[model samples]
Target chain A: MIQLNLHKTLSSTGGKMALDLDLTIEKGHFVTLFGESGAGKTSTLRMLSGLLKPDSGMITVGGTTWFDSRSNIDLKPQQRKVGYVFQDYALFPNMNVRQNLEYALQKNQDNSIIRELLEFAELEELQHRKPETLSGGQKQRVALSRALVQRPEILILDEPLSALDLKMRIKLQEYLLQVHKKYKLTTILVSHDIGEIVKLSDSVFEIQNGRVIKNGTAADFFGLNKTSAKFRFSGEILKIQREDVIYIISVLIGNDIIRVVSDPKEAALLRIGDQVLVASKAFNPIIQKL
Target chain B: MSIVCVEVDNGEELMSVVIDSPESAPYLKKGKKVNVLFKEMEVAVTTQKELNISIENRISGVVASVEMGLLLSRLILETNIGEVIAIISTKSLKQMELVERIEVVIMVKLNEIILAP
Candidate 1:
């Protein structure tokens, strides 16, 4: 279990604010911190990893005190068992794919994990390719694989898949789940993807103005109580147009963008770049072999 | 009708809210034997044991197994009454920890109980 009671003064584009957070994530459970940008989601992760200093409060992971303001105890990032994956796929520019992962290992650490992770992430063929030569998705797979070399029990992902396209992002979500389950890691993710949160996280914390305002199981927080929808597809809104008293909304699902007709009210609620779930009855589709 | 469903691992009690089971009203009695009939859409799964709700008949069962889909999830519950099958939102299953071996309470309304003489 990880317990965090942290206070930090942050300076960002939105202005300075005092962040106060009190949260607990059970072991082996996936948790998400969600909110608008600069909501202190990233800051909280950084503090927990010991990258940023918390002004006061306690941070405990599995009964070990990582930080205690009253007692003036703080562990360095290297001392804490944390594996961080950033949004940008922060790989070393000069190192090849395998080398980037090898760099994350501690001195005298066995190199077998590198081979295992490469195969697990399907990066065996691209191990020799440098970071700049790999595609965005491949780079991300490398980043994720590298994060696991240390076998850290606490995995922190800061918008790791937000930069990839929809298809690639989804493929990587599977990889993340694979590593999380295989390693039995307690994962903390900072994300804004509602569908992803509902699919990946056990619990969600909604942060606002550097404070945690609402927290609950993903189902309750998003009001995902409607169990009647049997046919559902998550996609992004690309365009909205009107046709003869009705609205046509275009959604990008996987590689194909399909147009769905929606009522005027629901069309008005959707905007470009918004993630949406196109749901209907199960028997509506006529499947054909191509 | 005797509904025979094979039980699986998740403990012994799971809860599902069954509705829209409008039975033949003439068949219900203390000493009468009747069959219950309902469609898959009529059953809803929940975790509440005791609460204020419209459901009248509560059958507590344990989650036996789950077949998960993209949006909906199918769960089999083993109870003293019998094995009940329910469909629920996938999100609810993941968040509620309603996997195999977990005890849950399944509920149904009085009017939803169909009785066939």
Candidate 2:
């Protein structure tokens, strides 16, 4: 369990923003900090990683004290069991992929983990390629592999996938989930993309003006079900048959076929292959994760 | 009567209630607007929080008015979304100690909601 009571003050164009937070995240849970810019999302991650200082309060992880303002106990970034992956993929330009992983090793540590990480991230072929030569996805994989070389307790990701394209981002999301489960590490992420947030996080903390305004299970917090009258898969029209004045539109949804009742002209403009929703009065909300 | 319950967004809130088939209520389509209609007697109110039951349609509101009678009582609940009217047995109403302005949770069963377009 990672528990924190953090307070910080920072100056922005909007004036002094006070970041006061008290949040408890369960162990092994992937939590995302979501908010607009200057909302103090990134600062929270920095404080946890010991890169940024808080004005006051304490941070504890799994019965170990990481920071306490009163006791003046502040561990160095290296002292805390943390692996931080930045948005820019902060790979060492001078070193290749393998060397970057080697750099995170402790003094006199075994080099076998380097081979393991290289193979795990599928960077065995690109082990000698410099950061500049690697694609955005390749560079991020290297960065992720390098971070895990420490086998840290908490993995901190600061918008790490935001720089990549949609396809790459999706591929990286799968890698992240695999890594999170394999290492059993508590992960904290800062992200703006709601799609990724929904895909990756078990819980979400929505911060605004430096405080956590909303926090809950990801589905409950973001999934409002505000769309049309609750058609889970909103089917597509495959065929339309005239039954007197009314029309029966055949809808092909996934592998199932559900027909919809429609009047002439839609009640106007519903054609074949167009997405049609079959809303039934009996079709009700079945509480499920979105 | 054979019924169909549909959910409606009354500009401020999404109200749902129902039982209907595609043939019974053909007006209900995806991305279309509809009206929600349910009975006052169908609205159930309680003061409990974070319940784990199967009621899907719910709202938190305060009693706008209460008309007490010997056998039954009528309650008008005012929520940010809209108002909900409820009718309950006077005996149960007295047991719950309900009064005007008292915050309460109103719930409706899935089949109780009716949709009209």
Candidate 3:
């Protein structure tokens, strides 16, 4: 388990603000820090990673004391076994992919772990490629692989996929899940995207003005209550065509169009340019690949 | 009974039957329209190469996004029928290897469709 009750003062462009956070996270769970800019999400991560010292409070992980203001005990960033993947790829321009990962290894550590990580990250084919030649996704993959070389108990991801496009972001989300499960690591992520937060996190802490304002599961934050049997979307009716006893109705939702079939009696009530919502119940909807 | 026809993307069309009642008369009177609603839990997604089912409402589209919850995953598909959201088991998601832009079919029964003015 990870426990933190930290207080810090941050100086931002707006002014100085106090950041007070208290959180406890179970092991092998994915937790996210969600909020707006300068909401102290990054500050909380920095404090946990030992990059920033807190003004007061205690931080304990799995019975190990990383910080305690009363005793003035603090561990250096290097002393904490944390795997941090920053927003930027942070790959050494001069080093190749394999070398970048090798540099993160502790002295006297076995070199075989590098091979395992390369395979796990699917970077084996690009092992000798330089960071300059790699795509944004590839660079981020390299950064992720390098961070795991130490087999750290805790994994920190700071918007690692923010630079990628939607397609790439989806791909990396899968990889991140694989790595997190394989290592059984306590993962903490910072993100602003609601979809990403819902897809990746087991729990979320909403931060505001450097204080934790709310904590809950993704469903709670997304308001995905399961008791209801109704779904709705608004669209403009585009066309109405007659086919035998049924009328084929067309509606435009955003840039896409949906076709609906209705009885003649019901069709008589609708016309082109009409706005309507198509709702459905909890009946089974089959999904098949094309 | 009132029927509303909707045209989604790719020229595909769908129809919804709106049961006339005092509460729905104003919204369905003649011109005003609003968003569509369906139970979020009623939607299901699959990544199989082919599907054989009796559900009459079948639309094909690329996956727009996937939101994974503890037990369920919310999938948004950009089909010719528009962007439809479905919730499925996480186990099935991993088993089918469903990801963005992968073509899949979404099926909904006709009777379950509700129309809001």
Candidate with the greatest TM-score versus the true structure:
1
> How are the candidates ranked when ordered by DockQ, highest leading?
3, 2, 1
Per-residue alpha-carbon lDDT of model 1 for A238-287, expressed as tens digits? Answer: 99997643467899876679888664546789899998877543434578
Candidate 3's DockQ is 0.06
Relative to the true interface, what fraction of contacts does candidate 2 keep? 0.06
| Model 2 vs truth, CA RMSD | 15.8
- Full candidate order by TM-score, most accurate first: 1, 3, 2
Q: What tens-digit string does per-residue lDDT give for candidate 2 at B69-99?
A: 7767778789755777787778878999999
State the lDDT of candidate 3 residue by residue for B42-113, as single tens digits: 556655546787665667778898766566677878877576777677778888888988888877655556
Could you tell me the TM-score of candidate 3? 0.62
True C-alpha contacts between chains kept, each model in order: 0.00, 0.06, 0.12
- Using DockQ as the measure, the top candidate is 3
Worst 10 residues of 1 chain A by lDDT: A223-232
| lDDT (Cα, tens digit) per residue for candidate 3, span A64-155 | 99999999889998789899999898999999999999999999999999999999999999999999999999999999999999989999
Pick the lDDT winner. Answer: 2
Interface RMSD of each: 15.0, 13.4, 13.9
* Segments of candidate 3 deviating more than 4 angstroms: A230-280, A284-290, B1-117
